[model samples]
Target: MGRTFHRYKPQKIFEKELQTSEFYDCKEKKWVAVIPKMKYRFVIALKSDYPREVFDAPKYYMMKVVWKNGKEQVFEADTKDALGDAILRFRTNECFWNNLGRYAYRVYLDWVNKSGRLLQ
Candidate 1:
């Protein structure tokens, strides 16, 4: 019998709407995706130690929300879909309001009203 060879294709992680451009961070030496918002931005990076091809989806993602005033929070998810859901929750005010306070939430609302998709 002859040996068989098969080509491998990486699976897509996030849906179309949840997808974002990724860039390599020289300081961190990892691939990361940055999602910008009205008052803060989410930085999601691969937690794996081994290097991966740019198109490959990692198993673990680490999310960091960096606020305008330099405050930041960290979160983790096993899949990219879950990470996207977390970001959506923060954007739609489903959670995390208390930490940001009422004032920040109002500001975010105003921005969403005035600029619409500019928040994304």
Candidate 2:
């Protein structure tokens, strides 16, 4: 139905939530919401080491996200600077789980193919 990229699909449905206490400045002993709202992310399932030609590429790293209000999003992973750095900028607290998530990492040489099902 949709753009089939390497057999990646919605196998599992879950959202990895990131929550933390409101930040409180030392000088100002008061707590404040980070954004005055809650944050949510999604998790989807896809194939591992999925062949290139599937999406007219060599491989794929697909992901699904469920937003707050129940919305689904699917997209590919972009590799420009560094994957580790990307994780650091986003999931700093849960970066440890990056290497153990549904995100797929591939290259022309050695590659990593895994889904949320197998990894998580």
Model 2 Cα displacement at 74 (Å)? 2.9
User: Native-vs-model 2 lDDT?
Assistant: 0.38
Q: Looking at model 1, report the run of 10 residues with the lowest lDDT sum.
A: 10-19
Candidate 2, residue 89: the lDDT equals 46
Q: Least lDDT summed over 10 consecutive residues: which range in candidate 2?
A: 104-113
In Å, residue 112's CA in model 2 sits off its true spot by: 8.9
Model 1 has how many clashing residue pairs? 0
TM-score for candidate 1, please give it. 0.33
Question: What lDDT score goes with residue 47 in model 1?
Answer: 66
Each prediction's RMSD over C-alphas, in Å, is: 14.3, 10.3
TM-score of 2: 0.29
